[model samples]
Target: MIIKRKVNKEVYMYSIGIDIGTTNCKLCVFELLSLKLIDSYSFATPKINSKYGYDFDIEALYSQLEQGLIQTINSLSYAEKVKNIVIASVGESGVLINQEGEVVGPCITWYDTRTQKNLADINQKFSDEELYSITGIPIHSNYSLTKILWIRENCNINLQQVKWLCIAEYIAYKLTNQKRAECSLASRTLAYDLKNHCWSEKIQSAFAINHLFADFTQSGKNIEVLTSTISTKLNCNQPIFVAIGGHDHMCGSIAAELKPGEILNSTGTTEGLLLLLEKVNFNKSFLTSQLSFGKYVKDDLYTLYASLPSAGYSIEWFKRTFSVTDENFDLLIESLLNKLDDINYIKNSLNIFIPHLRGSGPPKRNIDSKGLWYGLGENSTLADILLSIFQGLCFELKNTLITIEQLTVTHHPIIKVIGAAAKNPLWLQLKADILGREILSCNIKEAVCKGGVMLAGYENHYLDKNAHIQFDNPIARYIPNPKMTEYYHQIFADYYQPFFEFKTSLEFKLKKDN
Candidate 1:
């Protein structure tokens, strides 16, 4: 039998936020009166097992979401209080060919690397700066534009009868029957103009993409109300307001209270290091503002990001390859910690690692870049090698931070960190030491979901000092040691020089061969 909690009569209204991530989908309900977290639920993303390639099942995904939302509301004391539902989704991965108003194909994921050749061809035809100027996103195979191009070129599917949609937009359409793409997701498509805040006609002309793309809308704008069918499915008769929620990274940054001179570091399947700035234009020599989204306030403030493709993935790969004996994650973490403790000679070791196993991401999208382990000899053990890899990832993050600092002229001494990797004490300490910045670890690690909830709260008039959910003091702060910071700076300089050289050489050779 299912039990339902009793709710206080005073707090009768609530806000809901749904986050659709690469690995999971989560729902969070917050009291509209107090803006406090009331209930939450999560489900693994439904994937179709295939011999040829992996693909997400849209029907299964919607089913999971439907069930998860029902379960989430049922668990709450004031289930009927929920009046607003906002969704934040992983952008670039979601692609569908919509004919009139129906989905035609499985939503292709951003992780799928099947369009490498298409990406190469597109890049060759259009310069990187031109693409960035048009779409505010670097040319990459992970983008929906290239994936759509791939489908058009390879498949017998008719491209004339479809409207492309991002995952969030599709979910919104499913919820409200109104098709629109949020600015945050649209910016990642390599088809939206950052300055004009609309679909780029020049880009569409150059790529020969369909003009039936979904309309772009700003986040937090109420588009529609829930239908009787959706209300019945959730066992609620209350009106449900549908508001646009943008990219996951942008939402996560919002949760962290990201402002000028503040950085939000998200470490999940991949690490996304983002900065929220008031200005859009920056010097072209170093970092670029690849994407921007409307801020919650009236005046313009955009979330600019630089992402690393392999952060937590590096740790996952290491765990799978090295810690076969420990099936439980707690035990694996303990084993890793114990191994690190046992390494007495690591204090004086000069090992270095470069984690480019699946290739590096932004400022340079080097597909051929391979992971490297330098200064490895007979004395190196699995534990030592693991430490090197961990440090290597930190070094890459540090390099990115340095570049951002140089280009943007904004230095954030403290970084707000969220996601699964934030739980790793070793990694956090390493990041602090390498970047020479204080790392503020969030108590509630699910910043993306919380950000969405915050948006819902704002829409429902429930955000203030009295709100239970506040992004103030960090749960823990990792401060860098002066001596260690100095040591790392010297090592970082040496490591970065060879790294860029290697990337340049690889790109040159690939171009020559092609």
Candidate 2:
């Protein structure tokens, strides 16, 4: 929904970056030489609520993507200079298509808990330890394996006859008629083997689902070109390499030049804490904590990732509940935060919110958990309620950050934040105080999409090795106030912990009863 035109007649080579996110699907054009964004377009991701859960409308999703792609290319001054198109998307959700180019099943959202029974059935056959060791993912309904199994059972489709492609790969297939899986996203599916970097024999032998998996490759590979018809439609004469961009968070990590000791706080619809590693290793703490280990977008590397199921998504829900549009979301939130400031909100909070509107993540990954709030006074104003919800989100993130530190065995000096949350000064300062850490928020917009652009340029050898360093991010640091940090620490330990534990117990009981 945003467009910016840059005219540079000297530029003859460009790269296209497509980011298929949970909330929005965006396309950006970057100069291959400088990686400067020239043009962009965005549209809402096509997902609708279903009886089973939220399912993506594959045709609608692809239609919007194609439209955005064509429009961006057509808007660029150097349309024929397009050299590479790279796709990055959220992990787990995917489409199943037949040999005749017909969609065979729904692309179920990863967070849908309808697959809980499917995962439980899987656990009876494979131990959690064995699954984690082979797949580097915990036995959770949020992973793709459970969703695929649920689809197989409900849709009653022949798994061998159709091909499975994660969201990004599906886009690649539609554009180039190529079916492949990137390493990082493939690892999100429990069917992938972490050690072998291919589809797992464990899943094949156990479930008899073999041909469903596509050919595997790393994120940086470009083995196909845009279809001739597509080329003509976009009025481009030059060949455009179609590169596979991996999971969105990992792509952001590449743009941020994230190192081993540092952490990337990627906050979008969902928020994740990612750490890079040179060696393939997992801790026993990961097994208990449910922290995910996966193949990095860059080959020969690994990632330790933990997530909060809802972050900005919660804010979006709040905005919708109040009928606030994007144009006014920030202004409204700032006004509310200021009102809170006048009342000494930090030292005296009457509400403790458990932000599980979607689900809970880490230490206890439960999709069945529901959102809950307590201590709302009869005199509570709208600002009080809003601030409570926001604080709950920060509290949940702080809990996961603490758990991630324990599993990784390092207390990072500063957290590098990417995505939309980094741009909101109110949220940044609040998070810094709650987490008791300095926040390094990247001001480079569309960082995830830029990562895709970087990969496309790097794959085509259009940029030098030091291009990541050249990103030259305008970082805004949020330092925690000493008194506020101390107060938050006490509240989290004394009040938030007990409230969260109680909600977990209550939600579990309600689920069991139903």
TM-score per model over all chains: 0.88, 0.94
lDDT of 2: 0.82
Per-candidate local distance difference test: 0.71, 0.82
Best by TM-score: 2
Candidate 2 local lDDT, 232-303, one digit each (tens): 877778888898888999998877878778989899999898988876565566888888889987648889
lDDT of 2 at 371: 86
140-162 per-residue lDDT for model 1 (tens digits) = 77777877887777655566677
Q: Show the lowest summed lDDT stretch of 10 residues, model 1.
A: 290-299
**Error of model 2, residue 343, in angstroms:** 7.8
> How close is each model in CA RMSD to the real structure?
3.8, 3.4
Superpose all Cα atoms of candidate 1 onto the true structure and report the RMSD in Å to 1 decimal: 3.8
Q: Which stretches of candidate 1 lie over 4 Å from their true place?
A: 1-7, 48-54, 120-125, 208-210, 286-299, 323-344, 348-350, 375-382, 464-474, 495-500, 507-511
